[model samples]
Target chain A: MRRYYVDYFLIFLGSFLIVYIVLPIAVILVLQIFDFSMLLKALQDERVLKALKNTLITSTATMLISLIFGVPLGYVLARKDFRGKSIIQGIVDVPIVIPHSVVGIMLLITFSSAIVDNYIGIIMAMLFVSASFTINSARDGFLAIDENLEHVARTLGASKLRTFFTISLPLALPSILSGAIMTFARAMSEVGSILIVAYYPKTAQILVMEYFENYGLRASRPIAVLLILISLTIFITMRWIVGRRRYA
Target chain B: MLKLKNVSKDWKEFKIENIELEVKKNEYFVILGPSGAGKTLLLETIAGIHIPDSGRIYMDGIDVTELPPERREIAYIPQNYALFPHMSVYDNIAYGLKIRKAGNIDETVRRLAEVLGIVHLLNRKPKTLSGGEQQRVAIARALAVQPKILLLDEPFSNLDVQIRSKLMEEIKRWRREFEFTAVHVTHNFEEAFCLADRIGIMLNGRIVQVGKPDNVFLKPKNEDIARFLGYENIFEGHADGSRVRIGGITLSSNVTTFGRIKVAIRPEDVIISKSDGEFEAKVESIESFGFASKVTLSINGLKLKALTTTSKIIEEKIREGDRVYVSLRGFNLL
Candidate 1:
């Protein structure tokens, strides 16, 4: 009888969480459907299209850069124990803990002359706040693999590099793919850092903010709805892909 | 053939020291030790997974201490079998041939698979195979490489009794067919007894005794080794010439010693009689073990264990608190 109440309480809490997270997106999606012409207009507008394209390109570049550098760092962190490893992990999470605007300012001061107000600046801002997700996810993935697999490969006459590429990389692909998805999604939605560093080539988030400031809520609501729909579609599709590949 | 001379490794918590071993070609040398006795560590050191801090390893009369695992023609199967989960059975068996670019890879894999009885499972993933099937695949994979030496770490520890025995017989047959030298590590006395050409008893990181199975089992050098080899009744006795006295009983022995000494007697070797014969003892406890019953006898504040057949126990109607006679006819001095 006591367990029954506890189970009911848990169900209530879970339902509350689901509704709290989903209501806003549901409301936005339904609002855009009511004003279908505005959504179509936003989709066709050149400025909106350009901002969306810029967001996509910079987010993709950020994901690529994270893959290039973060995966190897994650492997080392997962497999080896050395001095200052905990400290290095804490440093990797610094961008996540610090304010995004602070990260923007730090980037502006450090690489102002080279990348400020350029396309690279947007990618840099996105990468700064999002690369940690990729690193952590990859590390967790590598941690799940049995160390004996690599040892067995070596005993079967595989060189270290060959074992890493042929065995470790394939076994860890699902986690790496999920991390890439998160990197892309985080990069796509980043705004506060780009606001301080590179506002000229506007991303979708910055464009939404600009419209809301220059205009009223009524004028900017449609754009928000559009961005929400696009992000939701891509995120869900990517998650589905990752889910399918996980068990394969 | 493989040899280790003064091989030693130092972990923070445990250490194996000054290990010396030599395995002849096509001989299965088993190192038997209890858990946490650095058995796996010693095996890994020989496989080149770990570099010994202070010794050399030789294979086929050539020093290969500094060589990496890939450079040495050694195949190691870990305790869990460690099959490549992402690959099919065929690919798992063919992995070494693919890496070495050996000719007729499919022919070799198929032949080995047929011998291992895993020919129909070639297309299935390792996760889909049963434990016995997966082990057969691991064996096929290791043998596919045609390694100079095969190393198995507790290969039969995870199987049921029936399967364990079956796998043991299978491994022996595989070795005969492929003609490979092997170094097997285990803690089970039955496994060591059934599989070893020569047995090495490891205690506290050292090989305390090494010889044929019968010699090592019957003549343990010290109390510790004797205890591990299933000598249940070990007592300190005063030795003078060939006679030893223990707790108001004098026993004759072939051992010629003249001071304090320890005597070890197997529980089965102590003769039990209902009528008066030798030292009298009270039955403290009797535990059944299928074919035999372990009878614990108490005599003059000393506890001793003896093994008697269940039929004998039933015929004598031996129960707790009953008095019996015990004779130390076959025992060894350590």
Candidate 2:
């Protein structure tokens, strides 16, 4: 009887969690559909489109920068054995744990406040915070490959760099793509750091915050709803593509 | 066509020291060793993945020790058949050619896949294939570019026993058919016997011996080499001519041993008889193998194993704690 009671409690707890977790997203998606006219107006607005374009451009730049710089670092982290590796890894992961506002301050200190006020500041901040995702995922992807494959390619008359591009990169494509998606998405949603560093040319998050602060929920709801829909579409499509790839 | 001179490496836990070996052109050289014996390390060193701390590698009489793997023109196949997962089988096989900027990459992949009997798997992804299919594809991918030499590092270790044997035969046939020179590293003796024209026995990162398979098994230069080759029954005795005097009994042997010599007898070379004979031994244990039965006996306080057929066990009713007469077969005396 005690076992049966415990089992019943577990069942209820699981169902409660499932419902509670899913309820807010479900409510938001449904509520937006009823506000179709507002959604349409927001979508048609040039300001929304401009913010959207800015967000995409910044995210792509961040993603490319991460791939360019972080991938080699990740590969070294995964494959090389040396002193201070743990320390280097800890440093790489600092952005994920540090406060976003503090990251903005750190960028201010490093790049100077004037520099932070420029477009480069936003890109740098996004790279500093979100680049870790790409590095970590690429590291994991490179690590999953057999060291012998590289050796085999080398014996088969391929140089180290050639083997890396041909075998290692191709094999780690799925993980790298997932990492790219994650970095892009994280860059899109970042508000606190960008608000501090680059605020003149408004991003979508900045626009939403401005609307909310100036006109309250009625005016901001449409923009907030628009941002959520855009994020949702990109996130969902990227997840589907990742799901379809062969992970091994 | 391949040579390593004074190659030495220390990889934290494993080390290969001052290793020297050579291979002739078109020879299928197999490095046979146990796990962690530095077989893979040597293969990697040859493939230029790990730069040897000290040594020179020569290929076709030219020094290539410092050359990158690509410039060396060797092919390698790793264990687990490391196929590119995102690419289809055809694309995976064509990658090397495409990277080299070779003409008609499609033609090369198709011909190689067809030779390896993996043509039907061209459109499929690596993960969707069976172990045998994946292995074939990996080999085909390496062979497609027509490298100067091929190196295999425990490539079939993950395969099932049945498939391993079948593939072993196929690889042996493939080498002859294509006149491909290969350096194979494996822990399996059966594979070495099946595929290797010459075998190099490696231990602790050094080649202890390299020769024809039969000679290495029969005439080991040292006790260590003998022990590594399954010569389990090593006994200290005095040799007078072709007979070794052990305790108070003497037996004829093929091994040329003098004073203070170690004599090794294979388990299959001992003959066991019931009833009285010149020598007496007590049955210590009995182990039943599928084709034969092994009976353990203590001959004058030394434990020795004797092999007999299953029918002999049934007829003689051999079991634990039975008195038996053990005779030396006088052959395979290491």
Alpha-carbon DockQ of candidate 2 = 0.55
Tens-digit lDDT string for candidate 2 (B87-118): 79998788778778899888878778777889
lDDT of 1 by residue, B53-138 (tens): 99899998899988889989999999999999999999999999999999999999999999999999999999999888888999
Q: How would you encode candidate 1's per-residue C-alpha lDDT over A184-222 as one tens digit per residue?
A: 999988998999999968888888988889986656777
Best by TM-score: 1
Give the range where candidate 1 chain A is weakest over 10 consecutive residues by summed lDDT. A215-224
Model 2 chain B: weakest 10-residue lDDT segment is B325-334
- True-contact fraction per candidate equals 0.89, 0.68
Model 2 accuracy (lDDT, Cα): 0.83
lDDT of every predicted structure (CA atoms): 0.90, 0.83
Quickly count the clashes in candidate 2.
Answer: 5
- Candidate 2 docks at the CAPRI level of medium
Tens-digit lDDT track of model 2 for A1-248:
89999999999988998999789777766877887787788889898778877887888899999999888988999999899999999999989998998988888888786656566888887888899999999999899988767766666556788888878887777888888889988998898888888885668888888878997876677777777777789889987887787443
Report, for candidate 2, the interface RMSD.
2.2
